[model samples]
Target: MEVPKKEDVINEMREILGNNDYIVQVVNTDNEVVNLLDQESGELQLEATANIFIGGSILDRGITIKNILCFFYGRNPKNFQQDTVLQHARMYGARKKEDMAVTRFHTSSAIYHILSRMNELDNQLREWFLQGNDQSDLNAVFVGYDKNIKPCAMQKIKVSDALTLKKQQRVLPVGMWTGSKTATKKMMAEIDHLVNESMCGQKLDADGFFYMNKDVAQQIIALIEDTYVYDEKYGNIDHKSDMRELLCALEYCTERSGGKLRAMVRTDRNMTRIRANGGFIDSPEDGRTDLKPARERALHEPVLMLLRQNGQKEETEYGNIGWNNAPFYWPVLLTQEDLAPVMFALDQRRKGKQLTIDLTEMLEGVNPDEVLKLSYAGNPIDQFGKEGTTYANAEEAAVETRWLKESVASLFIEKDEQGNWKHNPAVPFDEKNDHGVYSLNHGHFPFVLRDYKYILLRNGRNANAPLMLLELFPKDEWIIDPRGDFDEENNLLDDNGQDILLYGSDVIYDKNMNKTNFEDKSITLWYIEYPVKRVVKYKCLKK
Candidate 1:
């Protein structure tokens, strides 16, 4: 078998190659050239490859000039599977000098054309190819090829291979931090900024971002747990007591809308001594002795009365009234009507008599006219007339008069143009005058308003005894002038006849002989204002 010429083999190989095969071989040779060119030009270049096949007896006898020419003319050059002779002939021909030069030139030129197109493409899509630019355009171009063209897959595979090769040669530089502490702090600050920024835009879901950073989440959880434990251990006794008192007060206020009683007993007296002295008494000394002594102090009880109805068929078919519990030292009975049923039941049980009295009839015959007439007469009144001039003996009248005088005194508050209140003078007055009036020469005409119910008036410095001692009358006792005002209605008489209401006003008279002035007077007066009832709910602690 004669070997084929190089020119013949080159022609045969070209004839045997399909379009894809030829392009692939061309790409392979072009890739080598591109590497060489990249090194020379200090820039990247594209690469590609090509493949070819021959058939029948020509390929089996190996290649020859005649066979090569035949293959190029579209003949079945060889079927390498059926005849090794033709395959060998073609192989021998492909190695010839002329064929090598021609093959190399053809592949090289193809590569050059492909590389040129690539460079053109690179320039055309410079923005996409450049670093720091959006890679979306390049991705979009590749996606378009994948979707619209059939041979685009092969092109993409080739491009990917080229990219992999280029990336292998490229060396990435390493970075080092010059100042460790500063760089670490900067990085931490950046992380904190990012965390805060992420949290700022939305409702913070602890489970989401908080828990995403495990270390931070654990720290927060620990802090919260510690706080909860601390709170649980040291319970707030004052707050709890305050809450209870508030609730009780609210309940009392709800039950009694019109009026209520608040009582405070002075515990300074020796209660044990009094009890011991009274216990040694042989018998009731007098009718007064059976009654509790007035000196033996006891707190007043607050009571709420409510009316209830009974069925018509019952023998005592009437609305029975009762009193609700309140914060008090002793039990309280509200009205005369509330006392009748108990009295009647006790009488029946003691006497063992089954006498059924018609309560309604009995009540009707009780002569209410006399009782109503005597009601006003039995009330206590302030005897302020000539030595023994009897005033109206009515408790209600007295309380009304006192409340009126107090309310009239509370209206004036001397405020400057800026609405700021001026300070009141703090002067000690001689509390011994019989009229309960004191003279003070503290540069200002200072007058003190004392509780009329419990004032201890003194004439001069007597250290031992008050000149005119007054005691706190029960709320039901004491006269309150309904029309007394500190200004035009009931002005204080100064020597010059000018009204001397002065700067301090809005006075409160508690049962404890304490006077509270609301116009920013002495610190004592200021402190009293703090305990005043400002809201519907409150507590009264006896400290």
Candidate 2:
């Protein structure tokens, strides 16, 4: 009843393989996924397949191929996402270990940099993660190591990737993170020293960041570049950023801004795992190499904590074991105004010049109208009844509407990083989290890594409270039945993660229904979260 069309894909596949024997098929929903086997060859078929299979978005993750000898990934890798790349790394386990030698990675130089960066981060995460597993070490359990950028929870437990980890170099921090008041003051003075020397001729235009000249840029890099000098206890973490990356950034600045580049020496530590959903609990204080910052301020800016040694009671540095000397002693780069005046006059009562400045009060200015609230939008959920145009029940509409108007109050955070807050991240990663890990009772937003324009919060005295996003429409806006990251076995979970709805296998569709995901039979809480700006006026046909 169907005739084959002359498809460009088939021709392209034939040309690529240099053979006329390859097969290519375009699969539609009408053709069930279960029967995607060839009639003659009996090989597994997909949306499209040959000796080489090809697909996009749908093929980005989930499917596990055995003996996938070669990978030809030539996609653009600008702002690279590491989890996506890991998913595409089809070769794994002892089964495909031999396949590594012959397996080729044909990618651009940028992708190479991305991979190098990721691999470097992975090694550090593995080392610290293994150390953190010790429950008795309260310092390790509740310290600053929380901020290290990690791979998905599943990947964190594995160290068998011979290709990425074999003979791996340690990735050291860029500079010292200081916790001492004297150190903070001395550092601020040093910046003042640099400023007096460098800003003599450099004009402060409204266009660039602090220390806006190229020479100053060079100076900052030079100061921090070699600070990773010899350390006995922790050995060394190879330098993270270098002249090459800075030079590239400089070049970009010069070419784009004509003659100026507003540069900033970013003292940041907000690296994240994009695809890993360790569930809606708030992530613990991201550990840093310096002492932890005040709690309230931690929410806005990434804070580096001074950590204890991985295995010992002392801090993770090199000093005479009990003399209280920091193993590492680097200075924090900060604005002179934010730092207390350098303590030139020291007295017995003065502790290292006493730079007792509250960074939180300085950083988090109280914005009177700042809306920490999440917004919700869509077809009136559950309220639409048999009338189709009116409310299913007055009580349902009234309850939902009253709930919508109510606002969520600000949260209470504590010293041990616990509070009346809902984003509790005590949930372990690297495993199944369907019922246990994800709880509606917790008032936290689901953990996801996508760049959402906004967030929403579902309201009401419901069993499960969900976070929401605003202005999301049906077409591409609502990410219904979205996919989750791989589990420990590398198997994809259908019911968990962002926008994923699990229908218990059977899905009978009604063609007349709007394209949002209610057609699927998922038992999970309706944490409705899709969004855009509140100012952008839009409409949904489902309404």
Question: Backbone clashes per model, in order?
Answer: 43, 25
lDDT (Cα atoms) of all candidates against the true structure: 0.24, 0.32
- For residues 96-204, write the lDDT of model 2, one tens digit per residue: 4456644556655544556666666556546546765423211121111111113344344343211111011111233122233344345445554664565466664
- The candidate that achieves the highest lDDT relative to the unseen native structure: 2
After the best TM-score superposition of candidate 1, give how far the Cα of residue 156 lies from its true spot, in angstroms.
77
Candidate 2 regions with alpha-carbon error over 4 angstroms: 1-19, 24-50, 75-79, 92-94, 131-543
- In candidate 1 the C-alpha lDDT for residue 543 amounts to 15
The lDDT of model 1 is: 0.24
Report the C-alpha lDDT of model 1 over 173-222, residue by residue, as the tens digit. 11100122332344334433433543455553322211123233223222
Report the Cα lDDT for candidate 2: 0.32
Give each prediction's root-mean-square deviation over alpha carbons. 45.8, 22.6
